[model samples]
Target: MNGPTRRGDLFDDVDGARRFTGPTTGDERRMLIDVLRAQRSTLRLKCSGLGPELSLRSAEPSALSLLGLVRHLADVERRWFRQVLAGQDAPPLFSSTTDPDGDFDGATDDPQVVAAAWEAWRTEVAFAEQFVTGAPGLDIEGEDSWRGTVSLRWVLIHMIEEYARHNGHADLLRERIDGAIGL
Candidate 1:
């Protein structure tokens, strides 16, 4: 409890809370996107100030590390925005024949890899944000093979959930790496 608990950490500030003001015709598009953005920001905040060692250190069997989280998120963002939504045929950002979770597992004690993970994560996040902002009209009736008929709003919300879940894992990993804690 040195700083803010990462569990309930979501929004950075309430200044633009009005983004979700009024009804969205029952669509929580802006709200959901804002929520996702907040979670991503929280992830960045948690990873801030750490050097290559702590950032990439995996304290357990799982590839759950700060650097890994960054890489995974970048891959996720790129997949959703560039591939699925934009209908591109791009390959995965991380994971290859040599190593599965390369983004996470491949983060050596090297400064280059750590820096690349952070940069890729930021770039992908920006791209994803722009894509969502320019998203087509909300369509809850639409269908996906995996999610099935969910709105872009729902997709955004789920992405928030995904990031939040992994961020929760990251919180614990980071805490173990060092005594540092907070949103």
Candidate 2:
């Protein structure tokens, strides 16, 4: 892997991250899947090589943190893929009815908390990948309370949007934490 930026610089070398390996040419489904994976990889790269600082609420007044983003993305993966797409009953791993923000609110500088966040995120991500792979096609539809009938294609697109939006926030938070920037 390549090294980070030089001192006092905000722009890190893009090649250093190598988080975007998506093919420059592919069909719609393949392209979407690859872009989404690259977004996921970008999130991971933004949070890499951090210690307890991952839990630092650099955004202030909001419970946003690198660890929180990890946990929240895990919940998102579970909701859209397992519950909505696969018709499973998997509930939020880090949030609840009375604690909808538990994923972010509970983010702390504990080793176990950090470990659990990453584990849950990875598990949900793996399940989502499998579900998408085994899916007959993106046309497969599911009912969501918020969006009514939603297709796997729509879910994949929404997930890409979600990650892209959060990755932007992550960029700011990360820069605040360690002056690291660029993705």
**For this target, which candidate reaches the highest TM-score against the unseen true structure?**
2
List the candidate 2 regions with Cα displacement exceeding 4 Å.
1-17
Please, what are the lDDT tens digits per residue for candidate 1 over residues 1-183? 487555444434443344334444544676676678678777776676678644556555666678888888888787666766666775667876577678777766688888888788888888877877787655523444476456666667678889889878877776676655555
Question: Model 1, stretches more than 4 Å misplaced?
Answer: 1-27, 56-58, 140-150
Residue pairs in candidate 1 whose N, alpha carbon or C atoms collide under 3 angstroms: 142-149, 143-149
Write down the lDDT of every candidate, Cα atoms only: 0.70, 0.89
Q: Estimate each model's TM-score.
A: 0.76, 0.91
Q: How close is candidate 2 to the true structure, as a TM-score?
A: 0.91
Q: What lDDT would candidate 1 get against the real structure?
A: 0.70
- Summarize candidate 2's per-residue lDDT along 61-119 as a digit string, tens digits: 99999999999999999999999989999999999999999999999999999999999
Pairs with backbone N, CA or C atoms under 3 Å apart (clashes), candidate 2: none
